[model samples]
Target: MFTDEVVDSVSIQSLWRKSQQSSQESRGCQTRVVHSAEAEAQTVSATISCTQTEPQYQATQQLFPNHDELEPPGLKDFLQRVEDTVIRELVKNAKSHAFDGFQVNWEDHSQLVSCLHCLQHPSAHERGLHVTSVSWSCTGSVIVCAYGRIDDGDWSTEGSCVCTWNLDRRALNPKQADLVIDVPTAVTALCCHPKQPALIAGGLYSGEVVIWDTSRTQDPVLVQTGMSVDSHREPVYQVAWVPMQKKGEFGVLSASSGGRVLIWTVDSDQGRLVLNSAYALVRQQVPHSSSSSFKVSLRIRENTVTNQSTLSEMYFRLKTMLVHVLSLSLSLSGEVQIFDLGRRSLRPAATIEQGDQGQAATCLAFNCQNPHLLAVGKTDGTVGVWQLSTDLTEQSPRESAQLEQIANQVAE
Candidate 1:
């Protein structure tokens, strides 16, 4: 793994793999041809050849010649390499100094984006209640804000609220808000629907998930309070919308601090949200090694992060067939676990570590354009970019046929 610093942006280019190697024999020729279907298009053909020959050695009288070696690097080549190294260091330092002094120059035709408005409650503007979470609509025209406070004990909803602001307006208008929800519980997490811009999902400190429709802001459209032990045991740390497998049907996935992942389906006809299923994450144990005759006990190290709490955040990669979750622990160590959501159980398929001894991750984001790339932000103001590659086995023709038949039957 290569660890490179990224101060501005990072990107990966397309990778190409060669299917065949060049021939070992000398003086070889190869030909390749391309076929075109359209009459207007051109058909091309090419030929390539390789030639190798041994050099004939001859004795020659040298007149004060000091360079006659071909094995090691010569003096001139060594000096040139040293000079290139010095030049590289100089360029790196110069760029670092320029950025540090805020001397960056931008093109005249470039556009700059700045904040145009700010929103805050009039009565609580000065003593500002802590903003716990925020979310953006699918169209990027509205902002949803949630309020809460940090407490040693369980949180209460004395002055908590959920509000939305119109981004197209120039100023914050009290009457311009399309939705303002007053709840008796503190809102901890918020997520917007992928297809519906007006639909919103909020997770509360009371372990309840509620869905609100902006068209009718009087109250929540659907509330799953889990009044009869059907909800999460702990606070819901994160919530995300899952892409529906079937048309016109959608679901919401929530992650809690109790190592539970719950899937809730939306029922528009009944105006209700119901829990479809729940998955539990279990701690994995290392197996003992066995020899020819007896078994040997190998000492294994314990993970401090796994012993403290469960998942902190969740991201679902629709194309990769994987679910990524960040762990919440007492220590500063950050850990991410990947699970195959296609399986019945929730055992982690892989685990990745982040941060140093005292640093922790603050946020994480996956590249939608490139499913194999992930970006993580640390508490120390550093970012880590990683590229992931998965090993998938190919199935035989008979197995593939059987799977296709099963899928066809299910569709029928």
Candidate 2:
């Protein structure tokens, strides 16, 4: 059961004032100094206005029932408060640690992954390394990719490999695995496409991007190479495939170490496979690049069909594209930018850098069921979920309203 509580006027004012104060604190001294005089004048004017309306406001406040005293905050308010508290705590945890990572459970709760006893000095013939990249496949299995030196004394030689873990059984068991690709360079990034169960993409330390089809256990089918265009000069950080449409037109998008985003289309025509680069999106061209921290994160969404009696004829007649590419990029300074395939360039969709400094966003994942919801993991070991506006310029009001309702229910 749930109930909504009408917030008291005084409480609302207090919350607003606190938020303003926090904003002021986030701004540097120059901005604060510049706004101080204006703030004082505005405060005096507000004081005079409040004095004139104090009696009327008190009268109105008295006329309303004292629901705050009787019912307090119900389930909705409690859940919102809990979410705020969790976000704050995660931010604090991230600020305190340098080596941290996050993993989301099946229930969507972000949990900090433990890195215990995994770092050890390699013996005469072995190397000691730590897990650098991780991915979860459709089969519910976890794969950890490592990159480091082979031994404590031998820094001349480096080794990297993918270790598969059976998450369902809660054990690291790659000993009997049928296939394992050994790379001469370090593993920079790894991703398993949502629709292509047999395909896996890996970015290497040598600045090479390799796509592998794991259907054949003995040898993986090499589909494409990403190093020729200098797209992966430093290292490939992230790779993902754009969600496919009903017509089966799909493409893969990858973000490299140099902050370049490349869109590669997957063509399956005439019984052959082809991966072609369609677009290259750079982040510096977008607004607010000075405050950004990381490269763009890519995601895809599938539109749904719904029924509205009054608009059914127009709805069915209107052709809607099912697939879209949504990218989230965090600037090195503290800005998050979002872009879509239809847009001319990337834009700042949402920013969440307040109270977070010296922290780097390491990973991002989107909710399969809710495309508007996204989870971002930072190097400080904190994960935050963000909800986007459901109003779609290309979608109907009924669909947007439904999505808004779902988001509201989930937030509550």
The Cα local distance difference test for each model comes to 0.55, 0.47
Give the alpha carbon lDDT tens digit for every residue of 1-412 in model 1: 8898869788975443222333344687777886668556677999999997554332222443445655465877788879989999998897784333232223221111111333454433343444555666776666676665543365564656777776556664743344667767777778877778888888878888888888774666565545435578777877888876798777887777776667788766776667765655543421234321221222221221223333232223221222222221222465444443222235443444554555544444443434444444333333344445432122344446656774585455
Candidate 1: C-alpha RMSD after superposition: 36.1
TM-score of each: 0.44, 0.38
Ten residues in sequence with the least summed lDDT for candidate 1: 107-116
Any idea what lDDT model 2 has? 0.47
Which residue pairs show backbone clashes in model 1? none
In model 2, which regions exceed 4 Å deviation? 1-126, 142-157, 169-179, 226-231, 244-246, 266-275, 278-412
Most accurate candidate by lDDT: 1
* Segments of candidate 1 deviating more than 4 angstroms: 1-113, 123-128, 151-159, 174-178, 268-270, 283-412
